[model samples]
Target: MNLIETTYQLNQKAKHIAKVVSVDNATMTNIQLRAGEDIVEHSSKNDAFIIVRKGKIRFIVEGEPVVVTPENMLHMIPLEKHDLHAIEDTDLILIQIKP
Candidate 1:
């Protein structure tokens, strides 16, 4: 078995991303963003599940904005247009699964 760390580090001031796990059909990515940082709109060919580990984010899907926090997770279907803006210092994990 293998182990991976999925925690946030304090005092993070810039956008950070790391791919912690990858296999034939899926991947797990860790993303950290400071307040006001954003990811430009894009679409993924694979289905995506986003889990907010800390703080909050404004997740825009197809031009609709949804606030995401640690209490809930977000899922996006394959090829859906989306983008994210960090409402505050945020840490999240993104899991993508191939069709």
Candidate 2:
């Protein structure tokens, strides 16, 4: 996955912007989110986490919202639903890992 630069188009109707950075070993998937965008509440069987790489976010993980800025990290355990909204021009690192 180091060599595989990928992207997953989100809901255009919801205005979510993102790109898949890598999907390593099928157990870990890394994604990057763009500003003025959001990730709607959803969940998977795996554990999920996020790292704020740049800017800020009004992040909602498991039904709670918090302001997260650069260098901050958020984690969502297995089966947890979440949503993330960019509070400004921002970038984020999203990870989905095997339980």
lDDT, candidate 1, 1-99, per-residue tens: 998987675464477899999999999999999989999999999999999989899999998999999999999999899999999889999999997
TM-score of each: 0.92, 0.65
RMSD of 1: 1.4
Q: Which ten residues in a row have the lowest lDDT in candidate 1?
A: 6-15
**What are the root-mean-square deviations of the candidates from the true structure over C-alphas?**
1.4, 4.6
RMSD of 2: 4.6
In model 2, where do residues sit more than 4 Å from their true spots?
A: 1-35
- TM-score of model 1 (CA atoms): 0.92
Worst 10 contiguous positions by lDDT, candidate 2: 8-17
Clashes found in each candidate (C-alpha, N, C closer than 3 A):
0, 0
- Could you tell me which residue pairs clash in candidate 2? none
Which stretches of candidate 1 lie above 4 Å from their native place? 7-13
